[model samples]
Target: MKKVMLIDCCVRGVHSRTLMLAHRWLAEQERDSQVEHLRLYQLNLAPLSAQEVEQRKDTALGEQFAQADEIVVAAPYWDLSFPSILKVYLEHICIAGTTFHYVEDQAVGLCRAKRLVYVSTAGGYVGQRHLGEEYVQTLCQTLFGIPDFVGIRCEGLDLPGNDPEQLVAMVRFG
Candidate 1:
């Protein structure tokens, strides 16, 4: 059986739009794949200071992050980007020689997971011209070597009187 790591960074718990979308996507996946939900809002995660970054050059944290078979990150868009907590979590997960390794002028991903999906929602019109998906896709591809990357965004949610069914449809099709 395979493992799926669901990283949920929403503080709204079940009420979060991103979480709702993630659960919807999970329903489309195989049943036997074990799901491990890691909620960032509940974790005692901290940004890696300069000293920690130095020490992370040799640590077990890298090995821990490399163990996931599949990765799904969910977070609501904040200030034109992901939440700060998600960024902190990413720093911890993306370790040198663990999630990625640097070679001669290039970097390679070391994780066993072949695919990764980023689920997000925006309160307002971020515009289709924005690289919200591309930003996340590129990061995963470049740092984790996840050749298969997908980004799903549900935007314009802050508008007055949005339809619930329509929101679900957008997320499902996303």
Candidate 2:
């Protein structure tokens, strides 16, 4: 079975609409793969300081990212971007010579994952304004060497008259 890493960046945990959708997706994916869930908030990861950057310590987080056969990130949209915790977790894993390396002055990814699925929920209709999705996709392709990038976004959840359950169901089926 393929090793799938599920990165949970949902700030609200069980109360988060994004997480509900993500769980639905994972349930389907689990039928065909081995899923490992990493909850960022529970980890309490801190942003890399200037001192930590210089030291370049070995981290289990980076190793986990590198070893996964596929990655599924569930992050809620916030302030036109994903949460700050997600950014910090990304920093922890995007280590040189681990997740990526330079060859002939060009960066090459060392990650085992061939695909990445980004799941998110937005309060308003974002449409083409998926900045957070784009950022993660770029990192997956350029830095992590995950050639296949997929994004599942459920928008307008917090808006009046918008049915969040129906939106999530659509993604679950389609």
Candidate 3:
């Protein structure tokens, strides 16, 4: 069976609108693939030590990330990016020779994923301020070798007179 890596970075727990929308998207789109659901909040993730970096090629996280057929990342916008924990998780999987390798002194991706879908929800409007999404999209091409990058976002969920449920309901997977 093909694998779909679901990296859940919704840190707000049961109250996260981002998490709510992510679940809806997953139920509708990823019923066929085997899902490896990773909740970032529950995982004891941390910044890599020098020793761990050297051993990353043999780590399970790196290998699984490389082998995933597709990737879905669910995170809310924070500090113009994402939670620090997601950064830590990314560092763990970004192993040389696992996710990427140096070629001619330049980094080249080695991951097997063909597409990466980034799902996010914002409180205020996020017109051109998708720093987090842009960062991931760049990584998909340059570090993960993913050809297709999709960004599905529901913004202004907390704005006055706006309904979060309606916004999430209106979000399209297309």
- Best candidate (score: TM-score): 2
Best by lDDT: 2
- Model 3 sits at a Cα RMSD from the real structure of 1.7
Candidates 1 and 3 compared by lDDT, better number: 3
Query: Clash totals for all models, in order?
Result: 0, 0, 0
**TM-score ranking of the models:** 2, 3, 1
The count of residue-pair clashes in candidate 3 stands at 0
* Model 3 misplacement above 4 A: 53-57
Q: What lDDT tens digits, residue by residue, belong to model 2 across residues 124-168?
A: 988666899999989987887889988888888989998887888
TM-score of each: 0.88, 0.94, 0.91
lDDT of all predictions: 0.79, 0.88, 0.85
TM-score result, candidate 3: 0.91
Residues 106-148 of candidate 1: C-alpha lDDT, one tens digit per residue: 8888888888888888888777554556776787778878789
Cα displacement (Å) at residue 162, model 2: 1.8
Clashing pairs in 1: none
* lDDT, residue 15, model 3: 82
